[model samples]
Target chain A: MKKLDEITKRMPPEFNDFYRQRIDFIKASIKNYFPDQIDKDFLDRVVGQPSLFEPDLKATYDTIFLPTQEYLGRGGKVLRPVLVAMCLEAYGADIRDFEPVFGAIEVMEDSSIMMDDYIDNSLTRRGGPCGHIAHGYALANVSSCTAFALSHYLFYNNELKLPDDKALKLLDYMAWEHIQMAFGQIEELYWTQSNVNDITVDQYLQETIARCAFLTFRGPMRYAGILADAPPQDIAVLEKIGEYLLVGYHLKGDNLDMSPDSPEWGKVAGEDITTGRRTLLINYLLDKADKQERATIESIISSRTEDEEKKKVVYELVLKYDIFAQTRDLAAEYNQLAKQEIEKLSVSDEYKLLLNQFADYATRRRSL
Target chain B: MLHHLIENFDTEFLEAFEADQRTINECFEAEYKKLSDTEHLEQNVIDEPLLAWDYRAIEPGLLELMDPFMESESHTPLLFFSILRDLGLDPKPYVKASLLLEYSYFALGVIDYFDFHKVFTERKQDLLTYSELTQVRYAAQYLIQYPRYLVIKNSFELSKAQNIALHKLYATIGVTTGIGRGAFLKWGHDYFVSLIREHYFQNSIYTLNNYFLFPAMLGAIIADLSDAQKDSLQKGFSALTMFAKLRLEKRYYENQDEFKITPPIYRDLWQLLSFPGMALMENGLQVDPAPYAEDKYPWFTGLYRDLNTQIQGIDMADTIKTMEKLETELFETFVSELGRVDLLPATVERLRNCYRM
Candidate 1:
């Protein structure tokens, strides 16, 4: 795990540049769009307490907002959204006007991560208490709501300035994204409660691909493609790039399941076990092992012991089958595929640089 | 948008409302006379302390947009009318309220989902202007704020009127029964109890909770404490705890798949985690038969009272006589609609289930 530190440290710099390039332009565009500030006081009056309308404002407005803004304001990886901006930048389209597009998307991604961590019940992210743990459930719940509101508000605000047809389409796209995410959550919840054979590893992988990763992953590429007004074939390729990144992100959870450096998900470790949440790791181990070993794993999993040593031993047994290496190989394969797609594009020199940079940065980052 | 709203509300009911305003006015005046006699009745006053729920303002712009509707009731009392106007629909206050009741009974929680909400929701496209959302938002806000409005309206109406016909109206209907004039105390008890039962139901849960809990908690808090201190914070705490317990109980049934795995009670589960709101209603009255009959009525016909002229125990022997000439007419209007409440009919079997063994 210590040996991996160098890779993690080096990984974020390119992402930082990626996001900075985005926010700088976003700040300007949003300013141009709304010359005056939105009057936070008015928003506060409408929001009231943290009801469904004002979820995150109710939850993490006090707790996570300050820190999250700082974290975001300071240098960090803007890998996903930057890819989107870069992809658009690569295409022969001018997108300096669409800054809120990036800010709103970043907000959505942050919410997804915050919520995912809570669901995973893993503690810590970027080396701090998980949002749920620090802010409390109400706050965490609100944090998600805030992101949702921002998305809707952004769509609403944008709708006013854009053509009515395009505004509706934008809303429709958002609704589609929400439904997909919700469907994915239902699948995960079902797997968590029911038997393994009832669940499919491929389905889990696919959900991660389409829902979690695709929204942000392909968002950049598609955004870039659309902004640059690229060919449909290029858009299709960008979608695949998103699918690749999603699968790679799920591998980050492999550390939570099979690896020894257990903080892999921080505080939320053992959440899946506590929740009986099935993942590919458990599915593979069950498939590879005999009935008795499967039963052994089931029993230990059911107990949900917090004992690190005991869980570690079980994790080690699963690891012996070379699961992590297998997962990594799959990741590498996707990376190659993504590269092939990038190669076909007659993108600008700047886009080519961004594509290569994101590919390397994604390949290096360990956790989802 | 306002024109569109007016079109949806153009029903035979409005014509009758127009034709019968004088009759309705007379009916209310007659009832007001009797209510004046019973004005000092012992039951309506709350001995227990109370406080307002959170002093939340309606979204500022929305409230200003809705203020005109709240002023529409020069003929009928403003208690129920403001609810409609306060909400952004065309300002037929009672008509809108009655319509809201239709949705309130069964479509409440289901409406929270975007699709179901379309019944209550203006299409996002339809709501092109910011003022449109403000209007829709306030109209909904009026419903959400129904209790406070009801309290204000009821107290004002009751103080002026002498007829108890309005009292009878509340005893029979679910819509106007909540926060009606003080004579509807019996009706209120029944209404709240039925609400307690239905509040566990998904379709009714959120609306009932939002409608009923907001006021009950507000009243419980306001009755005891002042605006400045709200010293009845403990009662507020109790009310909140009670609400949460009911919420968890509802959730237990709501998530049936997960419910199967969950223990029947949230007590142990909550205690382990120290849920902030447990044992909320421990101090309140623990009456048998769940306190009030689950099947609420707009009128409480007395079970017993000896008539001066009757020999055999007259059913109406013990009945409390109507005090106003117009009371009879007001009571008639309420009865006419009893059979038409199509949402979920109060069947004999349902009533039995709500009753004691």
Candidate 2:
């Protein structure tokens, strides 16, 4: 599998430098935020009773918690929490005070992935067996709920020592984000389950904005503004920027999923098509393809086969239609809009530069 | 029935209650008329269906929407009105809020129908047209946005804090009912795996709790109860949800697979017993021989036999009698625990009757 650095190396030197610095910052922050060792004592105390399962039930707890631990270790961009910390830093808030918020967001993201992998029946994630596959769906489901509960605990415990009102506000925001993400997820599920053929780009965009964009962009950015005690207008602006960034980020994700360079992507490529996910790429192809082409694509999607041969056929069509480039352009367009939104923000230049660089990387990142 | 529910209230309260009901009816009528007036606007649209936006056009079509897809029921209005009346709040804004909730529910139903039809059911022609699909998609978007719109619309009446809380609660309702419940059903259908009887039964109960029972309890607290009283009753409400789950499970056992799967109302009972776990018990007793029984957990073997025999021979009327007895005991316990708080006696009575009815 290609290292993320290899992908970053492909970008211009300045952009690569910015990206590397951002990654290093995130890695260092996470190291500081989490305990150096998740030893038995730490797990028992922090993860609480789940770690102290009775002898017979120890395996069950391991089944659930170990996969979460494994998946967290096999980290991706750590984008959401890093965004939270960056925004807080930009606002000159005590970034360390908001460690719980960062942890909560990262746990929430990982939990969503666990549940998503289960729901999508994904066999592999980050070049390893998905949580549900390594464990079982039942344990994976339980772990997802546990992660949500832990996020709730982070807020309720108010380890940041925020005022009551501020803590409540943060809790309210997290709840709202969770509900919105669920709504978005349900829409995607509904679309895939229905396997509706007449899907329009508008519908695809709506689902993407809800499922991918809101949590990734709007929610994290808004949370940052809230913690900073920024005015409502500023938070609103942050939300707008986050929305554009989210759309672009989601498009990049879809492009990677369909890319033939599977090992480099570090995920099971073509899982979207094989699982019949309603992607921007699929919607675009449906809109552009001729009748015979449309039928062929539809047949492949509906077949839901994991065969390499069928996946090859679909990938060939994606290439033939230049769907990857088209999607990439759409992402770049959103990234541009995001940059424009950043310019409208009244934040310091440092914050602006950091956000712009992040947006640039999001629109360009080649690997998962 | 409305009068009976609130007969103990003062004349002023009764009049206000009646007026709120009237207002709710009038608002629904106006909304429906607006929907009708714009029906023509959707007729010739070439875009993919924005069914979510043009909800009224799909309102009537809900009756024809098949099983496993939610349909708006008469109980929703009753539930809303009852909660408002019991709380003694000025129902005007809240009634309007309920309409937003109802519309979201309706939109979810329409989306579910489209999804379910696409996934199952071989009738190709009955699938939503492009225009109808657009309507449903738009309706879903509307559903997601309803809480925000409700806050904006009612911000003047509701405090900032109250608005935030209400928005969170309403969003909870939408997610819990639409996605949490809907996804479970879709997953079961897609996998062709037999539903776990426990999950199937408990999920149905939880669905009712989230959609109907919890909202009513939360509404009363928001509208009427003091902060301390609200805290006290929250525990009771949680208890009642558990009771309701047990009640629903007993109901399913009593009914067996006697109910129809279509029309959605009786579908839970049918679906709950459709899992592979229940397959052995579906026919007359046909237990695996001792060798197979030895490999299985001893307790499960015993429990399965007991369930099969009980389900096979149980009298519906007797089972209902037993279930009602158990429910009454649970309700009494809830009322007693809740009575420790300083809520009005009438309010306590209202809580009891709300669930009983």
Candidate 3:
């Protein structure tokens, strides 16, 4: 909640001095951002309507509503919306014009989450039973359906006040994003199920970039450009910046699954193995492995292992290739590209500062 | 718990409904004596006026004890509940319970400590509280027809009076937390909502609404909560579904169960029927549907079985049309039970009448 200039001052002094003028650029754009649009009226409507458990009220309470209510009241950082708001500011947007778009993004992100948890079969979330875990399979289905339908209401009903063109464009963009996401998920599932090792590192990286990083960073950046109807050259530059930053995210995102407790993740001075999935690390290792070692790696992975220790040996064998340093250097190269993309933008000096700050945050975010 | 059978309705024939109230009370008195004998349990009971419900509820620290008890595998060898069930204390005679937050544990005041689970408690406490206590009652609710979740779901067609009578059956599910205990005691604050939304909700509303709703009470049972929390919670209807599934689960252990992803679809087809509120069960609790769905529905059932068997190894979309035909047939079957005669025109008329009325 600190003023933009104040927060800019807190950044690395050089970075702050370089980006300080963007305080106005960001401040004007974020003056109207809303994290979530939930209101008392919405809550009341939720109560008044019969739950999927309506007639059987008390039993339903034990089985359905209480579980879901507990989850919502106890939940997350609402980070995706924050990502969207940042992109709007980078484009020098007026916060008033961007509020509806941000709210829509939150609902979209949350609804997708409802579906995501089901896909992952993850048990606990936000310190409570997931909607499905608490609601039972049938009713959990009911809750997801309702959540999906509710998410579209804000935009479709003209309730959020987006302009007709922007609203329609958002619908188009979201639909396309959903298709790419589903496509990426299907690819992942098919690969996992087939137990096939024929997939290339490029395909794996592309799917990860499209699914994990682009939508998180690019979609909102694109949204900001489109809202301002920036010239095509500027839009292209903005997208370039987004793509560069996303590459870094994809390189790091693979290890997100490897817990600190995991023995598979041992100390690696320079060389890192493919974290998991057939990343560039494992692919490089495969290229380097003697035929016997390659065959051995193929046999155990294609089949099942007895435990985590066995899995760690497989991971360790791949680390021998030093593909870890390869990806690390590659990620750094993308970070430089991100810097280059920001410098190419011809926006005013004030706008340039915001762009610089965005580039810095996107690259150094998790590193610091 | 609150003499519900008396205050809520005419239970002058207590001897008839509660054939063993004396034995139930006696069992509880002995249990109380045993609890009093245990130095740890002796401090839990607090004496307060019965009508001062709120005071009586929290005064027991019953919740602190119960919190450890809630996750005690959700079932336990608890005496009061067994006595109540043994005495046939059930919903058909009406039971009501409510959960309220207790004395403020936080000075910040936003967080309700009563609503939160007790994570610090040992697994042994979970053994005593959740797994042992609620699971037993939950198991019984699935196993015993008298206190089952299905019977509660079936109360909709009951007369206004009978509806009230059936509300008490929920008390068994409520018996544990009376104020919810260790609801998710050990569930830490790291997992994300993305995880909750994507992975947890496996079934869609369309599936439940299409297949499970109306005929089954599962939807209504979950819809029973206040509106504020609907978006995130996940619920299942195993309290009824599991009654049958438990038997199936047991058979699995014995290696006698049909091991397949496709559950026996015919159980609902043949057995789903009215609760004892309309028809008495002489021996068992499988709902009998001969009256509502009728013998004619069985031909469609056979067709379904034949279609499933036929389509097992065949192409997926090749069976889509057959599935579509079956879906239509099922729709007709639903309409037929609603007393609609004929198909297209009559179905339209029926829909119109239902919507208009």
Better of 1 and 3 by DockQ: 1
User: Relative to the unseen true structure, what is the C-alpha lDDT of residue B334 in candidate 1, on a scale of 0 to 100?
Assistant: 24
Clashes of each: 44, 13, 74
Interface RMSD of each: 23.8, 10.5, 23.7
Model 3 scores a TM of 0.44
Which model, 1 or 2, shows the larger TM-score?
2
Residue B139 miss distance in model 1 (angstroms): 29
lDDT of each: 0.39, 0.55, 0.36
Residue B234, model 2, lDDT: 53
What local lDDT does model 1 show for residue B335? Answer: 26
Worst 10 residues of 1 chain B by lDDT: B46-55
Task: Please give the RMSD to the true structure for each candidate, in Å.
Answer: 21.7, 9.0, 24.9
Candidate 2 local lDDT, A6-103, one digit each (tens): 55665556545655655655656545434334444433333221111112122223533456667768867676877787787777887656656666
How would you encode candidate 3's per-residue C-alpha lDDT over B1-357 as one tens digit per residue? 111101221232233335334443344344324322323222222112111112121212232322322221111111122222333344222221101001111100111121122321222222223222222222121111211222323323443222322232222122211111111111111111112211111111211121222112212232242222212111222111212222222223233123333223212211111011111111111322333243211222233233234333334442234333433443343344333322123322422332231
Model 3 chain A is weakest, by summed lDDT over 10 consecutive residues, at A267-276
Per residue, candidate 2 scores C-alpha lDDT tens digits across B130-163 of 2244334344443444334334444336554555
* DockQ (CA atoms), all models: 0.02, 0.05, 0.02
**Model 1 scores what on Cα lDDT?**
0.39
Regions of candidate 3 where Cα sits further than 4 Å from its true position? A1-79, A100-153, A256-276, A299-306, A344-346, A349-357, A360-368, B1-347, B350-357
Question: What lDDT is reached at residue B80 by model 3?
Answer: 21
